[model samples]
Target: MTLLTVTGLTKSYAGADGELPVLAGIDLDIHEGEIVALLGKSGSGKSTLLRCLAGLIPPSSGTITYRGRPFKGANPGTTMVFQTFALLPWLTVQQNVEVGLETRGLPAAARREAALTAIDLIGLDGFESAYPKELSGGMRQRVGFARALVVEPDILLMDEPFSALDVLTAENLRGELLELWDSGTFPTKAIVVVTHNIEEAVLMADRVIVLGGRPYGSIRAAYDIPLTRPRDRDVPEFSKLIDTIYRTMTGRADTPHPPHGLRQPAKRTPANTPLPAASVDGLSGLAEILQRHDGHLDFAELTDELSLEVDDLLPLTDALELLGFAAVKGSQITLTDQGLAYSAADVQTSKQIFATAAIEVPLVHFITTSLRNSVDGSLRAGFFRDVLAHHYTSEQVTQQLDAATGWGRYAELYTYDTRHEEYHLDTVPS
Candidate 1:
């Protein structure tokens, strides 16, 4: 049975220029007896979708029905577990767990009994009287779980619940939760988790939904997990699924192909193809590694060797691809001839190559050209920010500018004066 139904959901936030769309034309259903994971890169609207389902924020357009009834306000049938372990610092664990019950107007004695039961269920029985400050990170998160579970809602919504915890602690908590879930003693009938960790999603979700696109707020694909309970990460099927998800996330339909020993410059505008948040050093390091590996490596193996999550590596890979220094095709990244030379070249030689490549990037090109066109070969930083504001949020505009600044400085294309808030074309020959 479907516990929650969402159709044609669209959410937008008021921005400086106009309304910025987040989730667009999203259709989803949360069924009973299932754990659904919403997986995506940052800004993919995973948390926004969760908030819409929880009725914490109203969708700009769409219908959300809980058990066939449209949500009028906050959905009483769902409770949230936050990443930050949002426990009241002054409140004892017991009081924190009782908060939802108190709001529901349950009698004090009944609320206390329910809170204790939840605390015991989550393995925090002894910590009930302790304050959040007295507990470790894991212990505090356990309290967060108990607090959410004490409400006994039909569905539990988790927003990166394990992201802030230590790896071992997160693994232990995940195992305990799964054990409880398998035992059929879990308080919620359905679980919805929003996470960027592909392995974590594969481990816990019965179904995984991938979200992507500009602003990364649209559903791109979905897969049903067929693995049985107590999954083993070492299994071939597990690794295969991870690879498939990686390809999906990085795959671009319009990826350019080099021809005649020259890289094809992207025709996209800066707004459409925003620079990936990666540093010159990071992408350069990855290129050197690829060169050492004979210009190719399995994506998953590379991630394992670096001890980095997929999210950590994606930005670097994206930057490499954007600069025409590397190519990714279905779980394998191969360094191009240019990439090999860039890795082997001396600092000055590499800068010349990078400068040529960077100009092909729309944002970098826009900056260089704008500075060159100016009468004094200089322009205020606000000019670029104002141009980008139509397409990105204020925070996003800052990030884009930062990425461009790093690339421009490394390529000797332009220089930004922090004190004067200006960009000068002193390095580039007119």
Candidate 2:
């Protein structure tokens, strides 16, 4: 039976320029006995789509249906496990689990029964009175899971539920979740998990759906994970599946090498291109790794070697590409001479190299130019923020401005007074 259906799921927000579209033309159906994993880059609206599904946020346009009824504000049959455990430190595990049930007006005895069952089911049977701060991160997230599961929803929404956990803890939690799902005893008819970890998606999901590329998120591709449960990652098929998904996210591999000294010129990005947030130090570290491997690293090979998801590694690579430190084509990431030089340079020289490349990014250039032309050689950061409001969401503009501020200071292009939230020219062009 179809448990959930979404169609033409267009979402947008008011911006200075016009409506800034988020999810566009989204169509998806989750059926009984299915676990659908949504995978994507950082800003691809994976979380937004989940919020829309939960009816926590109204979409600008589109429809969500749960069991043939139009979904609206906090669907009665749905619950969410947030990435952050979202547990109240003051509430004990049992209390936390019963919070939702109590709100639904379940009698105290019934709520206690449900919470006890959920805590036991999630393997936290003895921690009923332990508060969030008393439990470890993994233990706290177990309470998050129990809280969601205790409600006995028809569908459970998980937003990168395990991404915040340490590796071992995440793996343990994923195993337990799969066991409960596959056991056929869990109350939820279906589950939708949002994650950035490619392997985690493949590990726990029956169907993997990727949301990628453009910020106006749409389903890029969906793959049925052919392997059976309790899957082995070392198997050739598993590795191949990871490679296929990576290539799908990156849009194919196997490009010929660029010229000896220079990388391919960057494609023009949007004026509000949410500039890469990976740090200069991180990008240089990746560059040095690629340099040692002959200035090229295969996509799948790097993931296996570094044990990093594409989401975790892509930002570093993107920063490298943006700064002319590397060129990524398909599965191959090859460093340019500039990248090689940066890797080999001392701290001061590396800063100059980064600055030379960073000054060309539109946002950085805007800040530099704005400060240079200021009458008093200074301006409030809010000025650029106002300009960016035309291009990005308030949250996105904040992140962009923060990145630009860090990169600008590192490049010696300008100085940011955090106390005043102001920008000042390092050297006024008189």
| Full-model lDDT, candidate 2 | 0.82
Error of 1 at 26 (Å): 1.9
Clashing pairs in model 2?
none
Consecutive 10-residue window with the lowest summed lDDT within model 2? 256-265
List residue ranges in candidate 1 displaced over 4 A. Answer: 14-20, 253-277, 293-301, 304-309, 335-341, 351-430
Candidate 2 backbone overlaps, count: 0
Residue 62 lDDT in candidate 2: 73
Q: Candidate 1: worst 10 consecutive residues by lDDT?
A: 256-265
The candidate that wins on lDDT is: 1
Residue 98 lDDT, candidate 2, scale 0-100 = 97
Q: Can you write out model 2's per-residue Cα lDDT over 1-430, one digit (the tens) per residue?
A: 9988898787766553455566777789999888999998766788889999999989777789988899567777689999889998888899999999988899999999999999999999899999888899899999999999998898999998988899999889889989988898887999999988788888888899988635467788899998999899999989888888878776532333322332332444334256877876677789888888988888778877888767678888878887788887777888999988888788999899888999988788888888888898899988888887765667678888888888888899999999999999888887
